[model samples]
Target: MHAVLKLSKYLKPYKHFAVLAPILMILEVAMDLVQPTIMQKIIDDGIVMNNTLYIVGMFIVMIACAIIGWLGGAGCNFFSSKAAVNFAADIRADLYETITYFSNSNKDKFTLGKLITNLTNDVEMLQRALNMLLKVFVRGPFMFIGAVLVVFFTARDLFPILFFVVPVLIICLYVFIKLSITLFRKVQEAIDGVNTRVQENLSGIRVIKAFNRMRHQVKQFTGVNEELTKRNMTADQVIAALMPITQFVVNIGIVLALMLGVVKVEAGANEIGVIVAFINYLMMIMNGLMSSSNVLIQIARAIPSAERVVVVLEEQPDITNAENPVKKEILGDVNFEHVSFSYNKQVEPVLKDISFEAKAGSTVGIIGMTGSGKSTLIKLLARLMDVDEGTIYIDGFPIQQYDIETLRNAMAFAPQKATLFSTTIEENLKYGKSDATKEEIKEALVASNAIEFVEKLDKKEQHELTQGATNLSGGQKQRLAMSRALIRKPKILVLDDTTSAVDSITEKMIQKNMKELKGSTKFIVSSKISSIQHANLILVLEDGRIVAKGTHEELLKTSEHYREIVATQVEKGGILHE
Candidate 1:
C-alpha cells in the first residue's frame, strides 16, 4: 500500500481523469441501485392495478437509467485506460533512464533477467492493476454499500441476511488474500527464474550448440518452467476454494430471505413485489462482494511487481557528477596515486597500491597473465569504477573533480571483448565521433588495419554488421573496434589487448600506425610482450601489484618477469631492442 502511494505521483497528471473515473463509476452504481426500486414499483403499482400507462412510464424510466449506466461505464473505462497507459509509459521511461546512468558497480547488483522482467513484465502487471483499481475497486464498494442501504430501507425485516452473509464473505476473503499474497510473491520469483533461463540460453545459444549441451540446457529450462507452473497452480488452488464458499454463503442468505418473505406474505404482512426487490438487491450485493474479492486478489498479485518497480525508481546512481564539476580539455597526462580497488569490499582487492604516470603523448604498456588486474587497471583509468582508496588524476587534476562525460569523452577505450551493434559499419564508426567524415573514417580504418577487409565487402563502409559483428571475423571485429576508438582522435587512448585476435604482422602494422598518432597518450594492456616491447614505459603486473616499471630495454635487464616474458615470446618473433 505504501508502494502504491509512492507511485501516485504518476497519476498526478491524470488527476482530473482519475477523479472523474470514480465519479462516473458511482453514477453507474446509482443507476444499478435504482433498478430494483423501479422493478418493485412496476410490479406492485402498475401490474397489480392493471395500469397500462403506469407500466409504460416505469419501463421508459428503467430504460433511461440503463442508458445512463451504460454511458457512465463507458466513460469510466476510457479514463481508466488512459490513466493506466500513460502511467505505465512514464514509469517505463524513468526505469530505462535510471538504468542508462547506472554505474558498472550498480549494474552488478541486479541481474539482466531481473531488470528486464521489471521493465516489461512487472510494469505490465501494474498497468492492468491500475485499471482494475480505477474501475472495479470503486464500483464494488459503491454498489455493495448502495445495495445494502436500499435493501434495508425497502425491507428492514430481511436486513439480518445481509449481516450474516457479508461477514462470512469478508472472513473468507481475508483468509484467501492472506494465503494468496505469499503464493503470489513466489509465483513472481518463479517467473524471474524462467526469464533468467531464457535470457542465458538465448545469449549463449551458440556456445551451447558448440559444446553439444542442448539437452542439458533443455533439462535446466524444464526445471525452471516446472517451478513456475507449480507455484502458479499453488496460488490458484488457494483462491479456487473462494468462489464456491462465497456462492454457498450467498445462496444460504438468499434462501433464508425468501423463506422469511414467504412466511410474511402468508401472514399478509409483505407484498410479493417488495420481496422480489429485496432478493434482487441481495444478488447485487453478492456480485459486488465477489467482484471486490477478485479486485483485492489482483491487487495482491501486483504488489510484488510494484515493489520491484519502486526498487529501481528509488535507486540513486552510485556514480554521479560532483557539485560545480570541472569540465576542461584533458592533456592526457595521467597519474595513479597509491590507487587500490575491489569489485566488492568482502573480496580481495583487484588492484593493490597501484601507482604510475604517463606523460602526454607517451605510450604506457601494461602486461600481465590472466586475472593479474590488467583490465581492472585500465577501467580505473577511465573512471568506469571509482577507486576504493587513493586517487587518479588526468593532467594533474583529480579524475573525480572533472565532469564524468568530459573525462570520458576526452579518452577512447577499446575493451578486451569487442562489441558491435546491429547496424552499418559507417554508423558503428560514427558512434565514437558522431560527425566523423569519410576521410577521417578512412584514416582510422587504415591505422587500425580494418580498411583491407572493409574494402572487400560490396558496400565498403556501408557494409552492415550483424549483432555482435558475427558477420565479421575476430580480427575484423578487433580492427573495427580499434577504428572506432581511433576515429575519435581522443587525447587519451586505452586499448585493452585489442590486437590479440590479429596476426603478428597486422599487430605490428597497428602498433606502427598508432606510434604515428601524434597527440594521443596510449595505454595498451596485452599478454604478448612483443606488443608492448617498444612502449616508452612498460609495467609488468602480477597478483594485483606492479612488480616492474621501466622502459622496455631497462626492464629487460632489471626485471626477471620481463626477461621471462621476453624469452617466452622472442621465439614468436618481433624486434626486442631499440
Candidate 2:
C-alpha cells in the first residue's frame, strides 16, 4: 500500500482532473440523497391529501435532481478517466526510460517477460484502481453518512436498525479484504508466469518448429495457462462471495426496518410516508456500504501491482556516469590492466587477469574457444559491464573518467548475435549516426557486403524489416547489423564474431573493407584462426585467461595452444598452413 502511495506523484500533472472527479462525485451523492426526502414530500403532502398539483410539483423537483445527479456522475467519470489514463502514460514513459539506461547486470535481475508484465499489466491495474478510488471513495462515505443523518432527523425510530447492520457489514468487509489481498498477489504472479511462457514460445518459435516440438510447446503453454486460470478463479471467488454476504446482511436490515415501521405506524407514532422514505434511505445506506467495499477490494489488488512497479522505478542502475565526467574525443588508445569480471561472484570469473593494449589505428584480434570470454572482453571495453577488479584506461585516463555517453559514442560494436529493429534498412543504419547521408549509408552497406541483396529488394534501402529482422537470412541480418555499426565510423570498432554467418569469401571481403578505416582502432573476436591470422597482434585465450599473445606467425612458433588450433583448422582444410 505504501508503494502504491509513492506512485501518487505521477498524478501530480493530473491533479486538476483528480480534484474535479471527487468534487463531481460528491455533488452526485448529494443529489441522490435529496430524492428520498422529496419522495416523502410527495407521499405525505400530495398523495395522502389527494392533491394532484402538489404531487406533480414534487415529482418535477425529483426529475430536476435526477438530471443534476446524472450530470455530476457523467462529469465524474470523464475526469476520473482523464486523470487515470494520463497518470498511466506518464508512469509507463518513465518506466521505459529507466529500463533503457539499465546495465547488463541490472537487466539480469529481471526477465524479459516479467518486465513486460510490469510495464503493461501492472500499470493498467493501478490505473483502474485509481479511477475507482476517485469516484467510489468520495461517493460512498458521503452517501452513507448523509443517509444516516437524514434517517436520524426525519425517522429516529428506524435509525437503531443501522447500528446492528453497520457493525456486521464492517466486520465482513475487513475479513474479506484481508483474504483478498493475499489471493490477488498470487493472481499477479500467475499472470507473470503466463506472460513468460508466451514470450519464450513466440521468440523461439523458429527453433521449436525446426525441432518439431510444437506439441511439447503447446503442452508447456497449457500448463501455465491453467495455473493462471486457477489463480484468477480463486481470487474472483473470494471477491464474489463478498457481494452475496453484503446483500444478505442488507436484506436482513431492510426486514428489521419494515417490521419496526409497521409497529410505529399502527401505534400512530410515525406517518406511512415517513416509513416509506426511511426504507429508501436504508437501501441507499446499503449501496454506500457496497461501494466502500468495492473501493477496498480495488486497493487490495492494486497494492501488489504498485509494489512490482515500484521495484522497477526505484532500481538504480549499477552503472552510471561519474560526476563531472571528462568529455573528450577518444583517441582509441585502449588498455586493460589485470581486469577480471564474473556475472555471478559465486561462480568463476568469466575473464581473469586480462591485460592488453591497442594503440590508435591498430588492429587487435582475439581468438578463443567458445565460452573463453571472447565476447565479454569487448563488452568490458564498451563499458556495458564494469570489471569486478582492476582498471581499464582509454588514452591514459581511466575509462570511468570519461562521460559514459562519450566513451560509448566513440566506439561501435557489432555483437555476435545481430539485433535489428522493425524498420527500413536506411532507418536502421541511421540509428548509428542519425545524420548520416545517403552516400555514407551506401558506403557502409557496400563495406559490409549487404548492398547486393539490399539493391534487389523492391524498396531497396527503404524496405521494411520484420521484428528482429526475421524476414532476412541469418547472414543478411548480420551484414545489416554490421552496416549499422560501420555507418557510425567511430574511433574504436569492436566486432564480436559479427562475420560468423557470412561465407569465408565475404568475410575476407568485409575485413579488407574495414582496413580502409585507417583512423579507427579495431578489436575483432572470432573462433576461426583464419579470420584473425593477419592481425597486427593476436591474443590466444584459454578458459578465461590470455594463454599467449603475439602475431599469428609469432604465436604459431611460440605457443603450443596456437599450434594445436592451427593444426586442427589445417586438417579441417579451413585454412592453409602458411
Candidate 3:
C-alpha cells in the first residue's frame, strides 16, 4: 500500500486519465451484470411462452450490450495501460536524477547490475502492476462482492450453501497464494542472477574473447537460465494447480443449486424460469470469484519487486547533507585535518589521520607507491565519502555543509577508469560544459594532445563514439579524458593517474599542459612518481599516512622515503612507474 501511495505522486498529473479508465471499467462491469437478468427475461417472457417477437427483441438487446461492453473494456484498457507506461517513465527519470545525486557513501548498497535491474526490470514490474491496478483491481473485487451479495439477497435459501463453499474456496486461495509467493520471491532473485551474468559478459566481452572463454561463459549463463526456468515453473505450477480445485468447488455449488431448485419447482413453490436464472447466477458468482483469484497471482509477483524497490528507496545514505543545508562559497582553498576513513570499518582504514592544506590555485601533487591512500585523499576533498574523524574544509567551510551537488560541482574528478560513454567526442567533451562553444572544445582537445587522431576520423566530433571508447586507443582515451576535465574550468580538478596510459614524451606534453594550468587553476594531481615531478607541493604517503611532504627538491633532501621513491623511479627509466 505504501509503494502504491508513493507511486501516486506520478499518477496525480494524469488523474483525469486514471479516473476516466475506472469509470469505463465500472460501466463495462455494469453491462455484464445486466446479462444474467436479460437471460432470465428471455427464458420467462419469450422462450417458454413461444413469443417470437419478444425473443428477437431480447436477442438484439443482448448483442448491443455486448458491443458496448467490448468497447468500454477496450477503451478503458488502452488508456489505463498508456497512463501506467507514462507514469513508469516519469518515475524512471526521477529515479535517475535521485541516483545521480546520491553520495558515494551509499553506492556500495547498489551494485551496477542491481541498479540496472531496478531501472529496467523492477520499474517494468511496477508498470505491469499499475496496469493491473486500473483493470483487474477494479473489476475483480467489484465482481466478487457484487455477485456474492446478489446471490445472498435474491436467493436467500441458496445463500446458506455459500457458508460451506466460500470458506473452502478462501482456504484454497490462501494456501496456493502462500506457496506461489515463495516461488515468486525466488524467481525474482533468479532474474537478478541472470541480469548479473549478462552485465558481466557485456562489460568483459574483450576479456572473454581474449581468454577463449566462450564455452565457459555459455555454460555459466546456461546454469542461471536453467535456475530461472525452474523457479518460474514452480510458481506457475503452484498457481495452475489451484484453478482445477476452484473449478471443482464451483461445480459442487452448481449441482447443489440445481438440486434444491428442482425440489422447489416440483413442490410448485418456484417457476422453471426462476430455477434456470438461479443456476446462471451460480455460474456468474463463481466466474467473478475466479477473476478475483487471478489478482492473487499479480499480488504474488508484485510483492518481491515492491520489496526490492523499497530496499533502495528506504536506504539511508551513509551520509546526507543536513536540512536547510549549509552553503559554501569557495575558490578552491582545501584543507584536510586529522581525517580518517574506511570503505567499511570492519576492514582497516584506507586513509588515516591524513592532514594537509593547500591555498587557492596552487598545484598539489600526491605521489605514492600503489595503494598508499593518495587517491583516498582526493575523494575526501570531493566529499564522496565523509571522514569518521576531524574535518575537510574547502575555502574555510566544511564540505559537509554543502549539498552533494554543490560539493561535486565545486570540483572535477577524472579517476583511473577513464570512463567515456558511447557518444560523439563532442558530447563527451561537453560533459564538462554542456554549453561549450566548438572553439573551446577544440582548444581543450588540442591542449590535451588528443586533437590529432580526433581530426583523422572523417566525422571528427560528429563521429560515432563506440562503447567503452573502443574506437580509440588507450592513449587517445586518456588524453580525451584529460580534455574533458580541463574543459570544465572548475575550481578544483583532481586527476587520479590521468596520464598512466600515455607514453613518457606524451605524458610530459600533458604534464606541461597541466603546469601551464599552475597558478591560475587549483589542481590536485595524483599519480606515480613521474607524473607529479613538477608540482609546487608534493605529499609522499606510505600505507595511509603522510611520511613525506615538500617540493621535489626539498623532499629529496629531507625525507628518506621520498629519496627511495625517486631512486626507484630513476632506475626504472623515470616513466616506468606508471
Each prediction's TM-score versus the true structure: 0.94, 0.98, 0.91
Q: Between candidates 1 and 2, which one is better according to TM-score?
A: 2
Residue-pair clashes per prediction, in order, are 0, 0, 0
Q: Which ten residues in a row have the lowest lDDT in candidate 3?
A: 518-527
| Model 2: residues with Cα > 4 Å off, grouped in runs | 576-578
Top model number, TM-score: 2
CA lDDT, every model vs. true structure: 0.90, 0.91, 0.79
Better of 1 and 3 by lDDT: 1
Order of candidate numbers by TM-score, starting with the best: 2, 1, 3
- Quickly count the clashes in candidate 2: 0
Cα lDDT of candidate 3 equals 0.79
lDDT string, candidate 3, 1-578, tens digits: 67656667888888777888888888787777777767877887898899989989999999888899898899899989888899889878877766666677565567666767778888888788778878777877666676677666666666776776778888888888778778888988888888989999999998999999999999999999999999998888888898899889988987887888788778877667766666676666666666666766777787777777766766666667768665655587888899888887799998889888888888788988788887777877777778888898887878888777777776777766789989999999999889999999998898788887899989888877888989788888888887888887778888878878877888777777777774333445555677776777898888988888888789889999888877786787775323
Error of 3 at 3 (Å): 3.9
Which residues of candidate 1, in runs, are more than 4 Å off?
Answer: 458-464, 572-578
Q: Candidate 2 — which pairs collide?
A: none
